[model samples]
Target: MLKKGLYGIYKGVEFRITVDMDNNLKIMTDKKEKTDSTFEDTYQSGVYTKIVKPNELVDCVSVTPFGIIKGEKVQILQEKENKYQVATGALLVGSNLNLPRIDRDSWLGWVSKGEVKLFEEITPINPEDL
Candidate 1:
């Protein structure tokens, strides 16, 4: 089954992110531990989830909103019909860049093996800064 959360690393720190149907991203540390709190002393409760620093960001394409696909810097323009449109200044990585069944093994492999340096860092500008 596909995992609900994405495990990734931004800079050097590890993080897990969940994107809801509305595209709201919730980033937290990838680790979790049982807490002292419990429900009726039977069910575990209150697991700790850490949030990313406001200024820090991850580079993994699977988790990042911006990326270099087919050599062009692109941002996710739309998501429909189980496909995504990633565009870069009128150019696009084409529809194939985003697929309903992503090749998670290859993508995650690149992330884990530190092979992402071959692609340029193309994080999009946050409008809030302007």
Candidate 2:
């Protein structure tokens, strides 16, 4: 199924990104817990992610419209029906690169792992186990 949100569907898909040891890393998230307005919870994770597409880069009548997401950049490398490659650009919201971070909020994705394409739900699901 395709996704529903504030971004675009395209000849290619969009991706959020991060770098570790100067290499691209995929974003991964795990909801730690629900709070009762008193305590805090956290999780240790090694996965990374970024969100792309489904956006037009401008808005009005919305405050924090890009809440969690501050900005987006896309480079169209080669876009086919199932494959998308691109050059890169991203920015910190409020121009605060000193403490820049990418937000993960139900962003759909497509990446080639070996000769296969992958999404978070697919790579982690057990079609047989279900």
Q: Pick the candidate with the highest TM-score.
A: 1
Model 2 Cα lDDT, one tens digit per residue, 1-130? 2221222212233322223354523222222232122222223352223322223221211111111222332222233465433222333321332222234312222223222232222122111121
Q: Against the correct fold, how does model 2 do in TM-score?
A: 0.16
**Weakest ten-residue segment in model 2 by summed lDDT:** 58-67
Q: What TM-score does candidate 1 reach?
A: 0.25
Q: In candidate 1, residue 113 scores what lDDT?
A: 15
List ranges where model 1 is wrong by over 4 Å. Answer: 1-5, 19-25, 29-47, 63-130
The models' CA-based lDDT, in order, is 0.37, 0.26
* Deviation from native of the Cα of residue 11 in model 1, angstroms: 6.2
- The TM-score values for the models, in the order shown, are 0.25, 0.16
> What digit string (tens of lDDT, one per residue) describes model 1 on residues 1-130?
1122255454575555444355544454323432122212223442334334435554533434544545544444434444444443341233344423234332111111121112233343331131
